[model samples]
Target chain A: MQDFLTIDALSKYYANGFEALKSINLRVKESEILALLGPNGAGKTTLISTICGISKFTSGKITLAGHDIIKNYRAARKMIGMVPQELSLESFETVMNTLRFSRGLFGKAPNDSYLEELLEQLSLLDKRNSQILELSGGMKRRLSIAKALSHEPQLLFLDEPTAGVDVELRKDMWLLVRHLRNEGVTVILTTHYIEEAEEIADRVGIIDKGQLLLVEEKESLMQRLGQKQLTIELQNRLEELPTKLSDYDIVLAADRQSLNYTYNMRSGRTGINQILSSLTQSGIIIKDLQTKQSSLEDIFMSLVNETAK
Target chain B: MNYYGIKAIYKFEIARFFRTLFQSFVSPVIATSLYFVVFGAAIGSRIQEVDGVSYGSFIVPGLIMLTVITQSISNGSFGIFFPKFIGTIYELLSAPVNFFEIVLGYVGAAATKSLFIGLVILGTSTLFVEFNVIYPGLMILFLILTCVSFALLGFILGIWAKNFEQLQLVPLLIVTPMVFLGGSFYSISMLSPFWQTVSLFNPVVYLISGFRWCFFGISDVSITTSLLAVFSFMTLCLAIIAWIFKSGWQLRT
Candidate 1:
């Protein structure tokens, strides 16, 4: 399928030979939310910066809405809006002027009605005339989004949009992002919040150490790589796993009250039955059992660690 | 450059400058007035005339040009510096505006500000000492040249500046000293012949001499020399700024 935004073989190397991004390729479909998950210095911001033409890429090609990022930067940039992490707004300008100016920056015709709607949507209507420095942190964050949306861009990039905001404001931002996607605006969000990706992303891409590790639909990624852990309460505190149970790959708890086994969901054999039979053969009885499905956070951690290796 | 995009950024910067109109418009006047009082009046009372004009009246053109040079640099540099430091430059770089539009918008607004401030100081100096602009056309020409020259200089300073301390380095250490030693308060003729020869090395001297020539109809340096220096300096600065914008020197890296 054709993508609304396509990044091919993107790479960046600073003057001092620091490689920021390495051969990252991504395709974002129209009107979908793609959560880019990564640890610090994982090249998330660098990718966004390159795509927006703010930072020069060492080598790569990016196309936005069918326009080349370098050859047709103006048209490509006109279709995309970005909200940076920092709330670096003009301290003295009114909120309305900020949005109006941002819209004009895109060469868009003045549409006070649209500006008004954006202000209202961001809950900034009452503060439209207020100075940016006077607004609260959350208000400033909202204003950044309002400014980005003011241009009526088809593609929106949020670089850690809710990194340090309060929980309530984060929820508001999430709903607002969802609303934007519903309106047919594709959102490419970079975030450290794994749960936020789980809650809102239609697709997730894990990037680590300047390389893209994986990109897949959220549910499909979970189903393909998710693991289930089985914990069995033991009848006795065994000093070690019995020889018969050793082949089951079961781990004994420190207090000897539990045995743990982990298996991939996609694998046909869960190993729970085999482990139970091995335990029975070793004359062990389980008193209680519980299971835990691998969470998005767990998958993210393991993926990042594996990539590091 | 997109015309509308340049207009928008220009308006945004102008609005920001005027948001505290009392501070932006009034502070320069007050500072200039203090200089006029202390240096133009008190100091001029002791020193004799330079050429045929009173020492106080002699410095008016230089002082006015001084204000234009310093303020244009500060306004242009800080207007962009703070944004870059606080990370809002990312927002601008990501916008649809091209680099030319960005430079034009910023440098244009900064020039406008210096022009406004120059006129204000010119009007204020009238109350202290009476002096006629011998060549109004030339005076306006020099005013714009000085503004654009310093504005481009400031544009370079803005990109080169990395922090608040770096922002203050040029205006305070380099520019202010140049304005002082460039003969803002005294004529280079007052110095020894060798010193007079050395004063010709200071770029600000030509800026001041050219501006003062427009008012008093005479200059310490030849009018042709001053005009040539101003034009050459402006051209050099413009070339450097255009290169910086083209290469995305400090802005992109």
Candidate 2:
């Protein structure tokens, strides 16, 4: 993948002396959907604001398509589009006027055809003539996205794009984002919904407490931190683990009906065969066996806790 | 600098103003008519004349300037302040439009509204009393300058204000006093000599004098001094706004 945007040594300090961002460095490649997952107060919004040139960085450099964000703000801003968390539009303005005005702000010639296409894509064509104040919350959110896309920016940043949305709407928005990616746009998403990221993100970056915990491919991250639980139901109840099978370090249920074995998937030697052979040699009959795999949420929580330390 | 960006924001702001035409246009007309009836007729009857001009005629320029000043400040401040207050400033800030372009679009629309209200008041004045326009060129210049200056003042106020109450402070506490003390209903010369001298410190006095000079060719302050004060205030306010836009002070974070 080719690097399309680069953020180096970024930091933000408010006038009130709050250090919201501490020296962040990240590289976003072209045509990749990168999800920035974080809990509250993790600097996700601050980082996006600084990169987009809306919030000034205390000290750092950001390059968008090789253009320095600070030195060449107009060019950098032109190449990037942002959908902020707030669904703020001129309440008195019609949907059509809002998009047209936003398009004109970029100095692009008025093209009704292009605007119509954008509105249609956003599912706002039906409400184009309606005032923003008349729209529902979901429609307003869609209008926000439409306005941002009017200029057709290459790098799109979505800050909690699906917050407070229902399951159906959320799924529709994810599909729309995926469509944008297919059209050769690079997307950077920030969300508190872990499942949203796990379902759609190609790469996941976890940030916590103003620091980047880790950035890795979603599959490899799971493989690296994932664990497994193997449960065996004995044919007969037992008072305790056999003295020989105690070496396996299995936990016997309080009722003595089952044994649970926890092991790291990354470890090559789980010794499952050894445990089975030993159990059989001791005449302990096994009735059923099952295994459970760790989910992405497990990895996310551990990563957050690991960074806290 | 980008043509499309300016057009986009300009068109949006203008559309918003017109969308609220009932309040934006109708209220100003009603307010201006009331001022004419009360201040121009009631007050003008007690005061016969000022600076060799009819009292009713003399207050016309002052009334128009007052309307323009208040509208300019209100439109400019509210246009930006409400978006910020409701968290919609984020949409504008994150858009491809630069800060300068955003200001131009918003303040430009405000200035246009102020000019429209000023002209409407001027037209309404003719219905009540006869006034002459001695210097059309100077009148246009002063009208344009007043709108721009107050619009910038509103921009600063919008950025500095955190709540609706703070937004009303400058218009209520600051602008009202300036307009009333600037000689809207009476000539500064009518006050004692000491008060007339003290009035020079109020910038609105110069604006009123300059605008009045356009209609009657008579002014309490020197023409050159009035022009100089206006240009200086415009420059200073523009500089502060430009700095705020560059720093993204309150608008961004």
Candidate 3:
């Protein structure tokens, strides 16, 4: 109950009998940033929407800062700030008024200084007087965050805050999320970008087909599911690995100019030296070589596949 | 009640209304004026009087009712519909505001726009033909109730409509024709007995007759019946809206 947010036995069944969420239970630690990663239509949005009270649940309860979402809906809602996945803004409204209006919607009194600081933090001070329609797409996304932060909710939900954003804006958003977490605001964001979760999430929750596959600390999830790969590019393309090189398990590049060897990092014998020596003995010329560490994407795929099986 | 939330939405709607002044205010006023020109002057010149009231003055209340009812619905429907259309309703729905406050913000702003446009049309009508309100208080009351009720209807239509064609279907083909046949241009008493009886069933008749009664002390239906009719219709609209919110019908998925 003392945790920032909690969902217990939550289920949502639409009128058409499509089950969007099934008996989901989870807890969000205070002042931490948790990212929910999933492919499209995997109930990521449904989960956030249900928790935010945008969509009603058929059964179960949600509590925000100990306020029951159903019985004390207003109080529960007041503790949450959500930036919806949709790029829906009042295009005619200026950035300043949009923040003011959003703050007012949350039943908060006017505080221009706090709003100005939020805008400054989001790098939107210059566009404060500009209508949202006049701003760039990236700027609009930033404004959405500024609007959500106006009421200073204890828990913030950024639903794909940088889904279509450019690299620069995404970096800027990552910094903002870190700053918010440092300020004691717990953030729960849903992202299709695995790299985003890896970049900012203290804890990552992978969901697929309306099921939460796993929730774990970022470092542990990566260590347990991660694999490393070694790639060698030959100076010349070959149809297949030569006979002497065949003993080393390898994957040929689609273009037939490269080979990749993958192995568990925790294993004592990687056998990489044997493979390299064998390639040299087989008279295959290696023009370049690179190694890649497994990212959250691999873990996510394996987790999704494991659950599907 | 979320007073500030209501004000936020209300102000936003008002700003949107003002932003598109030519479309929202001027166009309706011009259209109402054209109705005055065509029906009041052009046609009235041919027929001097209808039921002892000057022909030009007789159509005044009906024309206002016609515009007010349509304006309320259009403004109300579009006010909420555009958000749903553009997917902005998600943000509003996610806000801390309750369903009643959301409705109040949208429908209230819509009703205000209808009232504004209705008054503008009334002012425009004065330039064509002079008229009087025998019961000024009742005229305002009916005006408010009609605007609010029809606005609620439009909000429902906005929610239920899946496309633009469906949105205009009721107001254009159904409601507009009902208003014209409901005695906007001519008195129901001027019609034959069979046709007049059918006109009684058109709900707009009571609204127009009640509104017109306040103007010329003459009406097709009693003022009490007209008031009751509009009140009950408003109550029905409210009930439907309540049900929509409770069931999370189209709003939640």
Candidate 4:
């Protein structure tokens, strides 16, 4: 896929000399879902703002669909849509009017059918005529999505789209994001919810303290950094871990009923069979065994922790 | 040119104005009627004439100018300020439209609104005073120039203001007083020489003088000077707006 959006060595420094964004480089491929995962004040919003032309970057270049964001901003901005984190809306305006206003502001011809379809997809058709103030928090979030997509932008930036949303709505939002991706709309979403990125992101970018720590394929990152744990449930209670298991990264459960063995996924030999054989030889009767793969959240925490050091 | 973008913003602002019809349109008309009652009927009964025009009629142009100037600033400032206050300005900043289109939309809507109110006030004033517009074309020209220029100033104020108090500060403290003391109810000639010279320093004087000339062919300053003042004020506003857009001052961080 072609690189639809590129950020080359972008840096932003405030007048007071606080660096909001480091010299960052990133390229978003067309029709891909890129999730930016970061903690509070991690420059996720700053990066998105700079890319969307809301903030003036101190240095470097950004281009959208081959147009320089600074020099040809109109052309670049025309192809992009952003749903901000705050649910800021014209409280008196109806949902339909909001969509119409956004579409028109993006220089797109009014297309009622397209907007209606968007509302329907987001389950907001029933509330089209309802004023924004009358809508619930979840409904407002949906409206924000509808508004952002009203112009049919080739690239969409969802800045914490599911923040404060209920679990059901968050799931629906994930589904909508996937649907948008299937329609060939590239998506860049910043999220504190690791599960959101784990569920829908094609690629994940972890940023901390105004610096991007890494950007890699989600699956590859999981494979490279993910750890697997094997649990040996013992039928008989063990008072202590036999010295034989100490070398294998195994720990005895506090209740003395199970043994846990940790192993790196990338290693060729997990030593699972050896550990099981050792357990059997040590007269620890195994009732059953189970394994668990570390979730993206675990990987994310470790990565952020590494940077904090 | 992004005509659609400008139109969208303009229509959005106009719709908001209509939504608050009583506050935006009717309130000013009511206020103008009260002004006519106090200044035109009560006060005019004592001072029968000023500069050969009936006292009631003479204050007509100044009244319209006052409403137009203040309304233009209020509407223009609130139009942009509300969006910023509510955090919806992100859409405007991120939209494909440029600064020119933005000004055209916001300032255009604000001017149109003040123009409507100004014209309505003119009609309402006629109920209280006998009036005639000698140069109807020039009257409209001055009306529009005032609306556009002041609306532009309001846009600057809206961007520069950090809070609601700051937003209302200039229009309330500076603009309203300037309009009242700019010879809105009386000609500068009514004042002594020292005060007359002081009134000349007020920029609103040129606007009122120009607009009054449109009604009765009488003005404290030459028509050319008034026009020059209007243009200069407008140019200054446009220059500030241009700088705001260029430097991303207040509007962008």
Candidate 5:
């Protein structure tokens, strides 16, 4: 089965001898939102640039809809669009002219109606005649997305599309990404915010230190990595763990008021029964019990720490 | 082919040039006319004629060369350099168009802008002196070739420039001195024999002589050598540009 976008062992080594991207392999299914989560200098932008053929890769292959990004670049590029990490725009051009010009660069016929529709969709209708420099940071970013989508590309790369915007604009971008995905526009977005992936990505790929650490479905990755904590409210403040409860991974709360047992939910038999029975056998009275599943942020931090080692 | 891509980039650059009309077009014309007034009044009386042409008319061809060369180079460099500086080049590189088309769009627009300036300076010069073009066709030919070749050189300089100061380096340091020393203000024959030989080695001499020949039917070197020299230099600049794009030098990082 041919993926919509396939990166096979794509590697890029800068002339300064800094390896920006290690041997990376990734396959993005058609119409899926694949959130690329990584920390800074994690080769996320490098991978996107190399795939777009802006930065030449030292080795490996990138194919967009069955065409090589290098050899069949024109055909391959026509199927892709990129919203760069930087807010790079032709500052003097009006939103309309820039969109028309960008679409024309892909050899696409001039379609003012389509551009007008795009403007309306992006809420840029009022700013169509405005020069890019006059637009605010949020508007400029929307124009970047509009320009990237002007050619009606099949695959889109949004490199930190919502990196620095306010919460409102970030929500707007997430909605926009969801809209694109609904229209079957395959999206690959890189972000450091784990909650972003949690909100919209169908799948998530974690990358760090120039290498891809893992790629898994959003639901599965959550279930596989998420930890469940069982908090037992003590009838009385406890000083330490008893010998009977020593076998479990448990910690006393800061107030010395409760026992917090941390265990991976993926591993069956969360040791709830064992801890509960041991507590009863030890003659400790429990006021109440509560369970909490860790969020994606904690999982991401642990994953990054795991790879750093 | 990417004609649309070429046209888009060309329009983008041409629009940029027009936005700064005073700086891009008018300043050079005003400066060139002042040269005619000062040099024609101050130096004209001292030396009556250069090769039977009035001293005022004598420098017209060289003046055009100097202004056109510098205008094209600076415009070409700045047009591309600003995009790179502001990070718009990535948008260009990521587009579907090839490098050659990108270069053609930029170099073509730069050449066109400089050609218009060259003709404007020519029209302005006619206001000051009465001169006839010996071969109007060849005159336009040399003017256009000079604009294009210098524009190409500017493209190379733009990519190689790390900063704005470096962007002006070639036009100010190298091209200006070469044009001045290449018989712009005086005839090479007025020099001592040794200096005359040294002037013969300056590449701008061939360009000026060929251009001047189109005006007065007088030249310092045979017309063929002049043509060969300009074309060869243009070809060399083209080769360097091709190499730069192929290696992704300064463009890809």
Candidate 6:
């Protein structure tokens, strides 16, 4: 896949000398879903704003479809669409008119059929004639998506697209994002929801304090950092871990009825067989056993914590 | 040139104006009619003529100028200000449209709106007083220039203003007073020499003077000077707007 968007050494600074975005570099491939995960004030919105040309960058270069964002902004901007974090919409305008206005703003000819199809996909077809103020919060979020996609932009930026919504709507938004990617619209979304990134993102970029910590394939990221835990339930309660199990990374449960062993899946030897033999020699009778894999949330927390230190 | 982008913004703004028909259109017309009742009937009864024209008829040009100038500013300022206030301006800023297209859309719509209101007030004034436009073409030219120039100023105000209070401050405190004391009601000639000389500095004076010349062929200042003043004001406004877009001062920041 070709890089549809390339950002090199981009930095943004306020007049008061606050660094909103540090020297950042990234490339987004066509038809790929890239999720940017960050905490509050992590410069997620600022990055998206700069790419969409809403905020001016102090230095560095960004190009969309091989056009420099600043020098060739018209061509670059025409190919890009952004759904802002805030539900900013014309309250008095009807849903359909809002979409039409957005499409026209991007210099596209009128295509009501395309717009109607978008509305239908977002379940907003019934509310096309309804004014924005009349819609519910979820409906407004959906309308923002429809507006962004109205121009058929090759690149779409969804900034916290499901920030405040119900579980059902969040799922719907995820589905829509996946559907957009399938339609060959490269999607870059900023979110703090680990589940959202884990569920839909093909690649995940972790950012902290205006710096991108890492960007890698989601599965690779999980596999490289992920840890697995094995639980051994004992029939007889133990006051502490036996000296025989000290060689392994194992801990006795606080309740004294079970033992937990942590190991890396990527390692050639997990030592499960040796640990079981050792436990048997120590006269520990295992009544039940279970294992659990570390979730992406755990990996994310550890990475952020490492950076915080 | 992004003509479609300009048309989109222009149409959106015009639609908003039509949506609030009473506030945008009817209210100004009603206010102008009341001015005729109060100033024309009440004041005109005492002063029968001023500069060889009926007191009722002489104020016609000034009345239209007042509405056109203020309405242009209000319409222009609010058109951009409301979007900023609601944060919807992000769409405008992020769109493929350039600053020129954006300004044309907003300022053009504002001018068109003020022009409509000015023409309506002119028509409504006829019910109370009779007036003839000696140079109908020049009258419209002045009207349009005022609308466009003042609308450009309003666009600047919209971008510069931080809040609603700030948005209304200039129009209320500065512009409205300028129009009133700018000889909108009485000729500057009525003032003593000292005050009359001071009134020459008021830009609105030139606008009213030039517009009045279109109607009765009488003006407080020469037609050439009036035209020069209008052009200079417009040039200054365009320069400021250009700077705003170039620096990304308020809108982009």
Best by DockQ: 4
Q: What is the per-residue lDDT of model 2 for residues A187-257, given as tens digits with 9 covering 90 to 100? A: 99999766778778888888877877788897776456557889999999988888987777689998898
lDDT string, candidate 6, A16-48, tens digits: 999988899999999999999887888999999
| Residue-by-residue lDDT tens digits, candidate 6, B96-119 | 888789989999999999999999
TM-score of each candidate's B chain against the true B chain: 0.94, 0.96, 0.97, 0.98, 0.97, 0.98
Tell me how candidate 2 scores on lDDT: 0.84
Q: Write the residue-wise lDDT of candidate 1 on A49-103 in tens digits.
A: 7888788988988998889988898899989888887677878778898888888
Candidate 1 lDDT at B91 equals: 70
Where does candidate 1 stray beyond 4 Å? A231-260, A263-283, A287-309, B38-46
Give residue A32's error in model 6 in angstroms: 0.5
TM-scores of chain A, one for each prediction: 0.82, 0.80, 0.80, 0.81, 0.81, 0.81
Clashes of each: 0, 10, 0, 0, 0, 0
**Candidate 1 residues B130-209, lDDT tens each?**
78889999999989988988888888888898888888897999899999999998888889999888888899998888
Off by over 4 Å in 5: A228-260, A263-282, A285-309
Model 4 agreement with the true structure over A1-309: per-residue lDDT tens digits: 779999999999998999998899999999999999878889999999999989899999999989999899889999999999998999999999989999999999999999999999988899999999999999998898888899999999999988888899988989999999999999999998767888899999988778988899988765655589888899989998887778888988899898888898677888888888887898878899899987655666777677679
Q: Residue A146 deviation, candidate 2, in Å?
A: 1.5
User: Which one wins by lDDT: 2 or 5?
Assistant: 5
Q: Please report the TM-score between candidate 4 and the true structure.
A: 0.91
Candidate 5's clash total is 0
| TM-score per candidate, chains pooled | 0.88, 0.89, 0.88, 0.91, 0.90, 0.91
What would you estimate as the lDDT of candidate 3?
0.87
Candidate 3, residues A3-56, lDDT tens digits: the string is 778888888887799888888889998999999988888899899998887888
Tell me the deviation in Å of residue A21 in model 4: 1.1
